[model samples]
Target: MSFIPRRPPRHLLRLLVLLAVAALLYFYSAPVFNAAARSLIRVDAPAPADVVIALGGDARCMRERRAAEIFNRGLARHVIVSGVPYAWGVHTGDAAKRYVESLGVPAERITVLRDAWNTRREAMDVNELMRAQGWNRAILVTSPFHSRRAHYTFRRYAAEYTFISMPLEPEPPEWQPERWWSRRGDLGITVREYLSWINTLAGGWR
Candidate 1:
């Protein structure tokens, strides 16, 4: 009897193929995902605007700091802190304005729009303020992950004046898209932002 080497079974071959494909996907497609995640963020400090708007929701005060920095740099003489009072028993705009003031921005230069419940509402409030104040341009500040949706919503609602979307410094755990899939928290943030971005594109933000 002649001994013959048997070929791998078809089922085993199929399993091996799937494993190879998964490995390839994980290794080769990671950079693409990272680039996509980063694309949702935009940080542009344009020429001085009429006002700086810090869209509140950052418990870390990053947005307020950025707005203050911009104000101190002479980018804008006025800063408007925009958000509703959902936490801390104080209007979000008020809290943000206080923080900015603490950072050396003059209180008189600080304005608060405390009626915004969401991005759309913030856009509405900002637009009304701009028209009332005869302002022509604004710098919109928010967390990096939220920059895209915020920019989209604001542009959609405030079409008259120029709105520059400024994303804060990308801190880890909240803005790390490259390592997003490795951690549940980062992944959740990335996914949530993507969903909100899609909603904004679909005109669903009410």
Candidate 2:
């Protein structure tokens, strides 16, 4: 064969492609991810929803309680709280399960799913439960800032569930963050939500 000089290495081309993808992932998904997260963080009541399905803990005990108040007033007849009182006992679902039942939701009207280990797990559990029960419409209950991620994840996984957003209003000035732009959380909740929002926008989640 005639002496042929080696072609330029394809490594450079691969690097360029990698950089391009990174840039796109950051540019497109970053803003949307953050913006959507903030929207979730700031939304106390962006709109109406059917059932304020509490995400457990303070979200259920406090802010979500407000939303549940509306539900108790006949806004919706069904509310689903995902937790297993009989299994994990009080740590996960027991308190919430009792709380909802105390809200006048007859045992039959309230559906308790007690198996979620995290919000994503809870979302998936609730999704499956809703489908099984044929519950097509719902309003997810989580902290004001967390509502976005929870709502988004639940909506994404469930796919067919019709949902309205109802966030728990952040506590008064005492607990409020120093700035309006502060992310949402109770000890790591804000950070966790921020990451989750990012994952969803990028469509890179498992």
- Candidate whose lDDT is highest: 1
In candidate 2, which residue ranges exceed 4 Å CA deviation? 1-37, 42-50, 84-91, 173-189, 199-206
Worst 10 residues of 2 by lDDT: 173-182
Residue 179's lDDT within candidate 2 is 39
1-206 per-residue lDDT for model 2 (tens digits)? 79989777899889989999999986787565555445655343344444557776453366435545757777676776655444433544656767767766676776665675566777778777777776777777666766667767787788888767666556662133333335343425555656777777787645
lDDT of 1 by residue, 1-206 (tens): 99999999999999999999999998978898889888888777678899998886777778889899989999997998866767667676777888889999999999888776778888988888999999998998888888878887888888898988877867762577675677887788889888887777787857
Shift in Å, residue 94, candidate 2? 2.1
Worst 10 residues of 1 by lDDT: 171-180
- lDDT values for all models: 0.83, 0.63
Q: What number of clashing residue pairs does each candidate have, in the order they appear?
A: 0, 6
Q: Please give each candidate's TM-score.
A: 0.85, 0.64
